[model samples]
Structures are given as structure tokens and as C-alpha cells.
Target: MIITESLDNKPAAVTLEPLPDGTTWLYLRKNAKQVEADTGDETPDAKPWQCETAIGKLGADRSGETADTINAKFDDWWTYAAAWAEDEPMPTVQEQINAIYDTLAVMMGV
Candidate 1:
């Protein structure tokens, strides 16, 4: 099965391969358009990120898991894990506490 979506405005595709070793491998094709643009070629020759996610413990049935749902999960997981790369670093412990206090104070009209 193949799932394609526009990741960060670049065409990306994810290939789901069910392996014989009871593991499902997810392959990611990232920056597909960038490769073509950089090479000045219409054909994309980007090497896909193979075996990005492996599902071994998961049962055979992927209950109600569609391309959109899987993509969203991958997006959220990547966002949280790769925050340092594209966005501001996560807040410090003190900053988090202060923000929580500020929000509470505003809610309580303090």
C-alpha cells in the first residue's frame, strides 16, 4: 500500500510493506520535489527513507487506520520529536510553570 501527501508543501509518499518477518515497514519519500528542482530534471530521483517505522508488535488488523490517520500520527510524532529542527525549542521547566500560573491567574481574574 502507498500513501501520498503534501508534507511541508513538498510531495511525499509513504509505502507500507508487510514483511514476511511479521513486521510492517513504512518507507518515507521526503523532499521529492526538491530533488527534481535541484537536479533540473523533471523525474524525481530522491532516495526514499526506507524502513522508517516498523510495526512488529502490532496485530495484523489495523483497526480503522486510514492513510489520513496514519499520516496525522506520523506528523504529530515528527512534530514533537523534531521540534528543535524547524521550530523554537521546547520551553524550560520554569517557563512551563510560569505559563501555567499565568493562565490560572487570568482564569481566576487575579
Candidate 2:
């Protein structure tokens, strides 16, 4: 099942997949607009980050679990992921400069 949800006020696609081990996996793909706004990527087809959350045995059994229970589990994972993404640190200016320099050197026949 795939549903549309919000992450950090941005639209995201959430997919629910059942694993062979009876566990569930939820995949999230954030909107491209959010990616462009966050990374300044101007590519017409730039792809955003795809994150996955594993629903262990406790949250599995789609047939047995009620809709509310599944929704709650998904909501919890989504909230946690959003918080984690917000807390992630960006590269320092020096680090970015060094990375650019490295890329340029390789491009110019390193």
C-alpha cells in the first residue's frame, strides 16, 4: 500500500511492504520540491532521499493488525525519521570547499 503523507510539512510517499520474515518495511520518498529547496539542486529530474523504516514482528501481521494500529506505527516511524533528518548536521564550509577541490582535481586529470 502506498499513501501520501507529510514530512516536515513536505509531501512524501509512504509505501508499506511485507517481508518474507513476516516483518514490514515502510519506504518514504520526499517530494522533489523539498529536495530542490533544501539542496538548491536545479536539475529538472533531481531525485530526493528515500528512507526506509523496518516494522518488526510486533508491528507486522497486516491481516491481524487493525487499521488504527498500523497507522499509529507508521506515524511513530514518520515522526522519528523527521526528527532524525532535522538533527542531521550539514558539512562545514571547509569540508565543502575541500570536496569541490577534490572533484575539480579529478576532473582535470588527477
Candidate 3:
């Protein structure tokens, strides 16, 4: 699968394929030209590999010496992103009780 999306306002592409056992393989290719100085260029010769592991589990960050390394970076970012997204306080005990009571009331047509 070729995912063409803009990240950080730059065009990015991610290619993913599935292994025989339902594992996904991901590849990040630099499809656009860049100044060599600014390039964290992924070696185009790198082959796709299964997306698993702490970093590889999400196929997010694609810059690293190896597939595993790249995925590891992604895992780090994902952890932060997930936590940031859910940065809310837990419900209080009374709030939880109220929710249960609300559900019970609906169940009893109250």
C-alpha cells in the first residue's frame, strides 16, 4: 500500500505490504528531491521488513539505520502522541457512580 500524505507540510509516502503470516512490511522512500545538507536520506536500497516491535509496531517514524531502528523511533513518538492525545484526568469516584446510575436508570426506563 502506498500512503501519500503530507507530513509537516511536505509530501511523504509510506509503502506497506503484508508478509505471509499477516505481518506488515513498511518502506519509506524519499520521493522528492532535497538539498543534501538537509537530507536525512533513507538509503533507498533498504528493503521493507515486518512492522513489529516497540518502534516498528506503528510504522510511524521511518528514519533510522535499520528497519528496527526506524520503528523504534516511531514507537517513541507514538507513545508521546498517544499520551498527549489522552491527556485528561481520570473520572472521580462520584462521577463513575453517577454514570453507573445513569445507565441503570436507562435500563429500567426511568
Candidate 4:
């Protein structure tokens, strides 16, 4: 993963994947929750481990660091993300980040 600043001057996560020719490309994956349906016949059940958020990935990036090492350390990351999503009274930096991405995508053909 390579962290770089967007045109909006915000640090964003860029995941790099290698191609067969030994080249790589970047994809922006902001912190958020991802859910997928479970597959089982007859009986219905949600996947137990599928309810995870992006904290694990963040945690990996912050390995060997204490809780106090970071500012936006998820103490209220969920609420912040939600408020930003709905455009409430106060939005988190992550929400602002989405807007930046939208603008960049349109202007820069991302």
C-alpha cells in the first residue's frame, strides 16, 4: 500500500496490485464497512466473519502502535463516518475526502 496526497491535499490509501508484466496500478479504498451475503441452502445465516469493518486493515498499518498514537483513532470513527455520509451538522474528514475524490474523478478522469 502506498499512501499519497490527493489533489485536495488529503492523505488517502492506495492499494497496489501487480500485473503479469510486473507493473502495478492504484485503487483508492477509503475506510468503511463491507458486507456480503452468505450462501447456504435451506437454512439462512449471515456470515459470521463478514461483518468486519476496516479497522483490521488500519490496525495492520498501525501495528506495534499504542491507541494514543493516532488522532482519528476510531474512538468515534463510526459515528463520524456516518454523519459525514448523511451530511449532518458536522462531517468528518473522511466525508470531505469523498467529495475530493468525486471532483478529482470528474476533472482528472479517474
Candidate 5:
């Protein structure tokens, strides 16, 4: 089974294969989607990058409180992780995801 990770790099859709050792080999696949930036109620056009900023701690800033805030946030974090993976010293995949979740937890007060 293939897994598509979310913006936090949380792996999804896990699959397995039988190995000669009578053990199952686990496999994970990331759903790579073309990220599109938040158009802010406007139709986007003629932009190569979904986000305005390519390289940084996060791909985009989503400090806005809007109806599409969740979607925008997913894209923002997802793009940020992608960019961070491309260039810069980043934490482990698990760490990155944990950080995002932790932040969310704090924000949500859960």
C-alpha cells in the first residue's frame, strides 16, 4: 500500500510486501501534489510557484484567520517542508512532523 503524507510529512497509505524471510516489508509512498498558494479570494494565474516565498523556515506564512485557513495552512506547511528538504539543515522527518503537531496542539489548546 502506498501512503500519501500530509503537510507535516506524516506518512499515509502504508503497504506491505512479503519477503523471503517470512517477514512483511513495509512500504510508504508520499503523495506529491503540486502545491498552490492561497489566492486570497482571487484566482491565481501565471505563477510558477504556488507560494510566494520558496526558501525559508516555512514555505509560506499563514497567520491569517479566514474560512480557508486550514487548507491554506496545509499548503503552507507542506510547501515549507518541501523547501526545507531541498536546502537547509533540517531535523529528522519525524521531528519535523512532531514539531508541526506540537505547534498545532498548542494553538488548539488540546
Candidate 6:
């Protein structure tokens, strides 16, 4: 199953693949355009910046789980994984300017 979801308000592609062992693997890829540009992979199925983790085996009882239920579970796991990944948020404009100023100050031996 492949779905597009918002992570931190940014579009991300999430994929769920079932393994032979009954466990499922979940993958998340963000910024398709940037990833394609950076990797020079323009294929339609190109997966860049993809991260994956195994979701425990789905018991027989869960075989009839609805799409919404699966999505909810994925969201919960993804949220925790995202937090654990500790991806740095983009710096604000003011922060960028301060960084530049700090660099210049050091360059000029201030």
C-alpha cells in the first residue's frame, strides 16, 4: 500500500509492504523533487531519502483491519519514528541571517 501523508505539514510518501514473516515494513520518503534532483534519479518510482522500519507482525485477528485502522497505526508509529530520527527543522530567516553575520564576524577576526 502506498499513500501520501503530511509530515510536519510537508508531503511525504508512505509505503507498507508485507514480509514473508507476517511482519510489515513501513517506509517514508519526503521531498520527492529535492530527492530526485540530488540523486539525479528521475524515474517515476524513484525513492530518495527513504527511511524504513519494521512494524510487528499483524496477527490473524488484524487480517480484517480496515484501511483507516491501518493508517492510524502507521501514523502513530511514524510519529514516534520521526521524533526519534531527530530531523532538524529548517532554520528561520532571522536565524540564517544571524549565522551569516556570525560567519562574517569570524572571517573579519571580530
Candidate 1 clashes between residue pairs 3 or more apart in a chain or in different chains:
none
Question: How far does residue 72 in candidate 2 sit from its true spot (Å)?
Answer: 8.6
What digit string (tens of lDDT, one per residue) describes model 2 on residues 37-65? 24355555554443333322224545355
User: How well is each residue in 1-110 modelled by candidate 3, as lDDT tens digits?
Assistant: 22332232333233345455544445453444332232236554433322212112223332333445544565444453233322366699999999999999999999
Residues 29-76 of candidate 1 have per-residue lDDT tens digits of 433542222333553565323222322122256534444666667765
lDDT against the true structure, each candidate = 0.46, 0.50, 0.43, 0.39, 0.41, 0.50
Q: What lDDT does candidate 4 reach at residue 95?
A: 91
Q: Which of the two, 4 or 6, has more lDDT?
A: 6
What are the models' TM-scores? 0.31, 0.30, 0.28, 0.22, 0.22, 0.31
The TM-score of candidate 3 is 0.28
How far does residue 6 in candidate 1 sit from its true spot (Å)? 17
Query: Which scores better on lDDT, 2 or 5?
Result: 2
What's the alpha carbon RMSD for model 6?
Answer: 14.0
Model 5 Cα shift for residue 76 (angstroms): 30
lDDT value, residue 58 of candidate 3: 28
For candidate 5, the per-residue lDDT at 109 reads 100
Stretches of candidate 5 exceeding 4 Å from the true structure: 1-88
Task: Rate residue 97 of model 6 by lDDT.
Answer: 100
Residue 103 deviation, candidate 6, in Å?
55
For residues 1-110, write the lDDT of model 5, one tens digit per residue: 11233342333323334445444333333344445545565656422221122222211232232324433455544454344433445589999999999999999999
